[model samples]
Target: MTADGPADLSGLKIDRDAPPPETGRLRRVLLWGAVTVLALGGAVLAYRAANPASVPVAVARAEPLGGVPGAGATEILTANGYVVARQRASVSTEVAGRLNQLFVEEGSRVRKGQVLGVLQNADQKSALASAHAALASAEAREAEAAANARETSLARGRAQQLHAKGLVSQAELDQAVASDDVARARVKSAEAEVRSTAARVESAQVDYDKTFIRAPFAGAVLRKEAEVGEIVSPIPSSGGLTRGAIVTMANLATLEVEADVNEGYVSRVHEGMRAEITLDAYPDERFPGHVRQIVPTADRQKATVLVKVAFDRLDARVLPEMGIKTSFLADSPATGSAAGTTAVAAAVAIPKRAVREADGRAVVYVVEGGRAVMRGVSPRPLAGDRVAVSAGLAPGELVIVEAPSTLGDKSRVRVK
Candidate 1:
């Protein structure tokens, strides 16, 4: 402390009025208040940056003004499908020979009678002609036999007349009768020979026809396995002398998806249920089809029922033996389109994020009038990213796709 003065006024110091000091209690209160405000502001900013709730959404979500049936409906099950037709077959014949001529190449359009190929049949053709000539000869013989039988009948009659007049003996009459009987026998033999010749002709004709292979149906040739002059035969042990085939023709319109429905889901897959086929070849487009038949028998080996979905339209790109994915739309459109001729019912489904557990209850935050309204919910099955909603959620209801902690009744939200 300075000894002389209550207030030191040094030569360097001038008298200046100073603000009054605040009361101790008020000063402490004001300091604390200021600290509290700053702390509160800092905490709010931090929280707004850290949490999704405070994130400013550029697009306002369409609020679920009200709940409707299927507000959060989701698909419970899903399966892939392939576009296909109902009638398809791989044609093979018992006849085998050297492939003499291939009438069609791969991708050639053909009619039912259009010959796909012809096999070497020089021997068969010659046999047919010979058999036919023999048949003609036999027919002539049959006619000659009839003439001889009539002549013998007349001779026997004349001999009988002579005997009656005593101009011919009984032995002569008997001889005439025998001669007539022999002529009848010749006629019978001739008839029999004719039948035999006819049989030969038919057999030869079959062999000749087999040599000229014909298409079984109207379709496009999918593959050509042989070239003209290539030796081919259907002989099983011919050491592959049987070149695979002259041509593989398929009615593309007859394509069908052979789907093996899981035995568990087969019961619901009755014939006439719609199906959508999306071929990997055409991913963006959907093909419409219908279940033509459900095999009553299940595959004992695979435990699945074969569901045949037939496409209504034919496309050149669609070929047999292609891998496919089929989806049964929940409410599949029945009508057809250029995109496809297939349709399937989609299963009830919902977004994966809408379902959550709160207070030990599986719940969904359904938006009602722009606010998150919590509701009790259940899920049927877990699917890709989405759960099939069994209860408490309806289709078309606005729900929070992103689940946030503390998301409950009356929470304000901005939906994407």
Candidate 2:
């Protein structure tokens, strides 16, 4: 076996010149294709980052000015304000005590004299019971005194007759007459005590009634200020352990807009002026309104006059404290009829930021079908941070506010 043991070992060696197996070649091609595809995908993502398909933008709707949008009335003034309830109150108990029960919650509609809550009245109940017992005892004493007085009267009469017949001594007759007088006095004293006890019972009843917290007027409860087991008081406590109000309620029927008009322009608005109101919560809705009152006083610090505007017809959607924009309409022939007092003009306004300057021309990026469309606008400066658009936009159309410089026509957008 000696010299031939490793014979023909060279023939078993691999041929580097030969092509790889079909499976190996297929796997290598696939790996290279995957790497190339991944590289292309990375490059595409980088390009997209530099040039976004859509832009993030702040937007505001083109709102009407002066009155209901497109109502075609002259707008005398524009003011921003909040809805307020003229008749609002924070109801509380007359006496301070731990809250025992609650019959209402936030948004609960309650009627006048309806029990809203109750305070722990165990002590008050005990006092009332005691007063009733005292009254009963006093009344019983009065009855006893009356009986004794009758008996004494009879005895006195008998003694008088006896004295007249000379059957009894003068001393015995005098004693009987004195007894009658004493008994009558006792009856009078007992009557006074009974009256005093009755008054005490009434006092106790008043104290007991105070434990129930009742609504002062019919209204919607805006907030439940006190919870069960919390101490409530008529007066606010400095220590903060007691709540000063059980609930805060407002008369929704008395909902009105309280706007502050610039003193410089106050003359343009007056009581009974026709107006249009748009609430921030319901921006698309135009509510007919009138100037209910022009507050006689002016705010010295703000240089503004408070104006109260009342809705011509109340809506269920209207709520207290909602932000609102009001257009005070000037008297015009269109609104001359008594029923046309709520007429408004056809004018539009938008936030000042919504209008942009492009090539010395005013432009705005209006959103349509999720795309920005640049349009020219004719803007007139208004009293506040708003501009009246005489052209190029319609009420309820959304325009990009403070749009980025990179944003262009036909750029996709998503409302924030």
Best by lDDT: 2
Candidate 2 TM-score to native: 0.63
TM-score of each: 0.55, 0.63
Residue-level lDDT of model 1, residues 305-335, one tens digit each, is 8778776444556677777776543342355
Candidate 2 lDDT by residue in tens digits, 1-416: 36758556667887889976697889999999999999999999999876667778889988765443334666767999999999999999999999999999889999999999999999999999999999999999999999999999999999999999999999999999999999999999999999999999999999999999999999999999999999999987899999999999999999999999999999888788888788998775567789999989999999999999998768788888999999888644454666656433456778888887889999999999888999998776543467777667778899899656888888888777
Q: Please count the clashing residue pairs in each candidate, in the order shown.
A: 40, 4
- lDDT of model number 1: 0.67
Error in Å for residue 371 of model 1: 43
lDDT of each: 0.67, 0.87
Point out where model 1 deviates above 4 Å.
1-76, 84-86, 235-239, 259-270, 293-306, 312-323, 331-416
